[model samples]
Target: MINVFFDKVEFFANNKELIKLIISNKRDKKSDLKKVIIKLIELKTELKLSFAYNHNTKDITKNFGINEGIILIQNLLKTDFFNADLFSTNETVQLISNKNNKVKIKTTEPTFKAIPKLNHDRIKKQRIFTQNNIYLQELGIISQNGKIKKDKHDKFRQINKYLETIESLLQESYWFTSGKPVTNLRIVDMGSGKGYLTFALYDFLTNSLNLDVEIIGVEFRQELVDKCNVIAKKSGFKNLKFEQGTIEKSEFKRIDILIALHACDTATDDAIYKGITHNSELIIVAPCCQKQIRKQLNLTNEMAAILKFGILKERQAELLTDGIRALILEAYGYKTKVFEFISTEHTPKNVMVTGTKISQKKNNSEILEKINSIKSFYGIEYHYLEKLLNNLSV
Candidate 1:
């Protein structure tokens, strides 16, 4: 049997185990390897992944003659360990050098040379879940650092980007007033379920960056809230906490950054309202459902023509709803931006509306007018955003 093993002298996620699994499942090993190589090339083309395997070794390595920048080990058990120089050419990828816990074999070499060693300890340290000790958290109720359940791909990506963007927004001058910078960053995540992003953000700001941040996650589920609280306590994160609250009834206070990720439709709007009401410096919303907008569009007379086509009407409703919300933010002196969080391919509805409350141009009349014009063109009335625009100060 031609045995192949991948050793982490390169990267953890790119271990030889992946090759073993692929080779085992594949119909034609060579063809499957070819596919993998092609996939690597494709990833390289897109700059999604860097080169992984190293190029040099002893006599056995010469026999294999690496493919996809990889060498197959015929007797992987005999060898104690191996490493892939994923970033031999450029130091940016990684410098891996580690032992095989199972085989008890170890190898060490310079990063660029054929002999490589992946720093498994560092790789293990990098995984957010492991590094943060999420596994130790309670079940049913998710803690701030709880292990994320599978099948939440959409939420994961959105939450990650939303948190980072808010951090970046804080650095912008528009988010400040009278040149008085908002140095003490306080953020609250409303309807914060599982706190995948909440914990992720705290990890970034507090542990990784060592920035002094006050972070809170508010969720209706008491269990999840309690779980988060425990995790916060255990992590020794004084600035992080979780509270039980609803967006509608929750009393939002002194929040510099407010985020609502996939707060179910109108709930997302409510979260936005609370942020603006509390005079939050930055508001980022990734709304999940648009059921309210969908229903309102059906009832409004102006939307009748567009409603003629169900598909067209649905798309129109989505755009109109978000557009009105954008205008409302503008009315409150918040500069709003709407963009795709992911894609329809990933999940049809991916809407992120970010707002920075600009003091001078709080209520940009031009932006408000443009939003109205868009509504008029689409015959969209009974807009939730428009309703709120008149309720609060810009």
Candidate 2:
């Protein structure tokens, strides 16, 4: 038997008919076939693909914005060599051909796709972090039967999304200088309630990304810290541990990433201050509770009518609080971004703030003036983050 792989197969212009034939007979029992995937187009904004399955029935599952790039498969004993032409902005393609006589292969550059749809069977079959993960089971995200709990479905998706974001961020060249890989990383997760995300991150960084990393999850609850430590030990995550401490009290000499998800009121500020003080490479937080700014926001003359409404005032405070935090991060020589983390259906506190430290310092007098003006206009004495950083050098 001969086997071959081709990366430059021209599908639309040449092999469309072949792909059609392959999908049409996807369920042929004699073929020993599994499935056929056809990526329709790669747009700058999204990805499109059709999955043709060959289990008990043959059906096509069309999906949009799937992140998996390409897959090629061949079965030599059955002469079932399958080649798929994956459409993309760059017109990328892959093909596998196995025959009795000879084999041939071709390769080329690869392009990235979007995250796969949730219903896609590949999500379960080829999960990057499997359901059998001991930490996930210990955390009750998955059942003892190695299945995701029905209620924890959203939680599972959130974990995957979190890992995906971190994976993409790690690929940036700025994180690695002169092609030297980062072997050691110290990550601190502030307010790590239940440690659901902390465990996922540690697993991905150590098991998936293959990085040597030490992770500390700081939670005020001693019970939770002890529980998480037990889970970490059971899962054999030697470099991953939990500590009973608040974000402000926790100290680390060196930190690579500082993460705080849904830290309440001023805790988000504490996390950011720690990241900035340690000069961490990355800081990510999904802030919750903006009462600090909301409580001090009086009905100013400029916007008394709108600010008088409770709902509007609350919404405005959330935005302003996070906005100021982003600006503060920027002024501290970190590139910052604020965006919706997830839908409100999953969690209302879904706004995520990301800060990546840059080499240049940017705490100019103008930035300070802007910060102060915003505070004064809202009648806020000090943004929690600002108050924390007032004595520290930016």
Give the alpha carbon lDDT tens digit for every residue of 85-181 in model 1: 2222122122222243232222333233211112222222342443335522433223455555465555555545554565456545343223333
RMSD of each: 13.6, 10.6
* Tens digits of per-residue lDDT for model 2, 1-394: 2222222322331322112213222323565446554434434433333445454456545543322322322332134433443333233344343333333333344243322222234433333565568988998888888898899999888887777667656654254432355677888899998999999888877766566889999999999999999999999999988889888988888988999998898999999999988888899999998889998887566786888989999999998899999989888888887887677788787889998888667555787789888887778887889889889765
* Candidate 1 lDDT score at position 374: 70
In candidate 1 the C-alpha lDDT for residue 201 amounts to: 79
Question: Each model's TM-score, in the order given?
Answer: 0.57, 0.69
Candidate 1, which segments miss by more than 4 Å at Cα? 1-129, 135-159, 171-183, 298-306, 343-346, 376-379
Worst 10 residues of 2 by lDDT: 12-21
